[model samples]
Target chain A: MRSHARIGFVLLLTPLVLWLGLLIVIPHIDMLLISLRERISFGVYETSTAQYQKALTEPLYLRTFWRTAVMSVLATGITLLIAFPVAYYIAKMAKGRLQQVLFMFCLIPFYVSELVRTFGWMILLRETGIVSNLLQWTGLADQPVEMLYNDAAMMVGLVYTSMLFMVVPLVTTLESLDDSVIEAGYDLGGGGFSVLREIIIPHAMPGIVSGCIVVFMLSLGNYLTPTMLGGKDSLWFTEMIYNQFIVRSNWELGAAFGFMLLVLSSVIVWGMLRLTGRTLQETMG
Target chain B: MIPTIPQSRSFRLVYGGYVLLFFLYLALPLTVVAVFAFNDSQFPSLPWQGFTWNWFFGDSDPQIGVFHERGILRAVGTSAIVAGCVAMLSVAVGMTNAFLFNRYEFRGKGALYVLMLLPLVIPGIVLGISILIASSTLANGVWDVAQLDIQALRPGLLLVVLGQFSFITTIATLVITARLQKFDRTLEDAALNLGATRLTAVRTITIPFLMPAMIGAVVVAFLMSFENFNTTLMLVGSDAPLTIAMFDRLKEGSTPLLNAVSLLLMLGSSLLALLVILFQRR
Candidate 1:
């Protein structure tokens, strides 16, 4: 029986070991190693940090990376601000059936793919699209204003894409909080803003941090939304990586840029977890 | 925020209005996508010409509907096959991971568990490129050493399956493990004590209990694989999945046929989502 259990353990462990080793762990390590080497000649590589060096020295690369990071953070912040009240209403304020329906509304759009969602945004924001037409009809503008291809459009798409990620976590955390506590705060002469700040925010911090981390990572890594919405000036760092790998065939530099994205995003996420007193296990789980 | 506490009328109005607007923001885009599927115009945008089904059924030169569009139909077939393969593989491996985590005491379990979740944090594009590099390098090495070619280790549908299966399995395992954690050990113990072998007991008792979550995982995995773009875009070769095909077309330009495609995708996925939700309710 003992050996049988041991054999079963090995059987289960085999696929997992193979999956993680071949697909997840080793590939990332290979990418790191590839990023460290420079193509000295055709197919002859020497180990160097020139790829990373180029990432740092090139103004285009540096600025794009900075913009992606900053935009992602901003998007996360905006998602939280928008999603918080909705989540608060669903979790704390709404009744049983209404709560479920409202939450379902939040989830239905996400069931469709991100590509479809971005396509929908394009249809709405393009020069000949609905929003422009609505603006003209409402007498707000005379011309069909081209709204597609701007930072603001990119931000709207980012926030819209990530809003549910924020709201889901916020709703989950907020639902577990006892309503009596909020009532107690109000009964103790706390104003609405004060109660929300002192009671609700503290209680919802775990969800807040987790949601922000996921949203920020998503926005940072987002390819379709930024590229589709923000035309010429998108300047997404992932585009740089894509250009390196697919367009220019510079795999080494692409690997370096990929590592920079991974490391920078991870560091910021770690910093967030530490500051918020949450473990990764807690957040992700 | 407390329901029991009465708020001012202005506050109530504002909160109610915000919720209303939030749902509108969520619904408007997809609604427009669906509604325009029936529009008579060639473009997917506004100025909706009177209603028509040309985008869904038209087969003419300029008005080719999604059903008649060969590229899109083939891509949809490719996506379905990929999603099916990914769903099966992810669930099988995910079940193994669930049992491994739930049924045994092991060394370095905590660390391995965290490692399992690491793919979720790694960006999809990074995961895609890393896999591409790793596979091609391995293929090249094998070719150099043994003059052998391995097709699986290349940028293609197989790579897309592997890439999606990587992170998706994490989700599957999490779902199955959540179900497993709640299993009553006594039922399996009762079966064992009642003259049943361990395999029989597990096959009949434990597996049936986990079937719902396993089904849910399958649906979730399939939907995720179908909708996946970032990883698939990086790894796709000659055969593009539906999302990739749609993306390529969008880059060049779009017609109302794409909106028709979106409408079909929406309905198909919503049906799948309903399945999972209904199963969960059970």
Candidate 2:
């Protein structure tokens, strides 16, 4: 019977293993190999270290890399600030039907494709957009403001796109908190604010940390929002990688850019694990 | 129970206001897109030029009109077919993996599971380009060995399906695995003890229990495939999926026709979700 079960397990795992091996593991190895190659003029590649040297020393690449890092951090911070209160209210205050409705509302944006959602932002933030028109009408500006095509718009798109991921985990952790714990803190003559500081926030730290990691990873890797919203001048790190392969036909530089991003994110993931005192698997799973 | 201090009415009002505003913020963009679907104007933003169905039904040089435009309709059909095949293939693969991982302990199960999740963590662009290169290389190598000429390996529906299935199956496997963990082995054992073959027991008892999760997995797989852009963008050859088509159109500039398409897609997905809920309730 044990032998039979082993056979069944192997049968089940074979396809998935093969699929990942061919599609993921092999491709990743290929990417690393290609990154080590030098791009020849005819849009072909040859083996060399020149591409890596250029990628490492280039000021353009370095600036974009740091800029993307800063933007991702800022976006993650802003998402946490907005998501926490909404999550707190949903988990601690809302009840029954209201909670379900509010949670559903949080999830509704997820139904729309990210492309459409970003496009919607484009419409709203454009010079002739309602936002600008409102500002103009209120005499807050002499002319319609150009909110689109900048870092601020990019952050808005990223935060809005990733808000649900932040909310869900935060709510899940907060909801598991025992009401009696808060009651006990209050009974000990702690004020609401003090109780939150001493009990609630610490207890909810795991969720906060996990949520931040998720948002940060997503924001760091995201290429679409920054491209569409940030426009020509953005030059985000991912866009740099994209240009290397798609526009410049330089696979090695693109691979270097990709590898740098992978390393950066891995470091962040490692830092988060250390800070939260949980393994990556524990935080994600 | 000790009575809690009643909060001031204003507190409730403030909290309620915040929730309401947040909800509105969430709904605003979608609401704008949906409303603009009915506009007579070409652009999505409006001073209403009166309601018109021409965007949906009109045929012109620039506007294909509604879901009826040849390109839009064709893209939708391609998307649906691709999404359907992807759902079926992923669920089949995922179910097998879930059953295997859940039912038996293997030496390298941990490593295999981690490997499966790599596609999810990697940036979509990276995955897209990697898959394109790997597949094209393999195809080229095969063609070279066979002494046959094949021009390209990356562009086509088959490649798109292959690209999508790579990540989507992992998702399905995760979902089904979660469900499988909760399954009672005793029921299967009881069926086997009652003289059913293992396959028979699995078919009659295990599969029946897993049906709802399988259906949910299918729905999720379909939705993911439908909305997939980054990977599809890189892998797609000639034919464009709705999302890609929309992106192309957006590059040229915005149109109310895209809004119409968005509205229709929203309705289609919601209706499907409602149907799933109803079926589950029954």
Interface RMSD to the true structure, each candidate: 0.9, 2.7
lDDT per residue, candidate 2, A122-217, as tens digits?
878888776887888799998878898998889889999889989999999989988888889888998768988998889888898888888988
lDDT (Cα atoms) of all candidates against the true structure: 0.92, 0.82
Second chain TM-score, each model: 0.98, 0.93
Q: Please state the error at residue A57 of candidate 2 in Å.
A: 1.4
TM-score of chain A of 2: 0.93
| The TM-score obtained by chain A of candidate 1 when compared with the true chain A | 0.98
Lowest lDDT sum, 10 consecutive residues, model 1 chain B, at: B41-50
Residue pairs clashing in model 2 are B55-B66, B56-B66
Tens digits of per-residue lDDT for model 2, B1-282: 112545677877887798778777788778777887777887877456789887888777555686567888888989999999999999999998888777777688777776676666666767777777777667767877997656456567888888899889888988888888888999999998999999999999989888888998899899889998877877887889888888888889888898888888888777777676677777
lDDT of 1 by residue, B25-50 (tens): 99888988888899898788777688
lDDT of 1 by residue, A1-285 (tens): 999999999999999999999999999999999999999899899999999899999998999999999989999999999999999999998999999999998898889999989998999999999999999999999999999999999999999998999999999999999999999999899999999999999999999999999999999889999889987877899888898999999999999999999998899999998898878878896
Residue B204 in model 2: shift from native, Å?
1.0
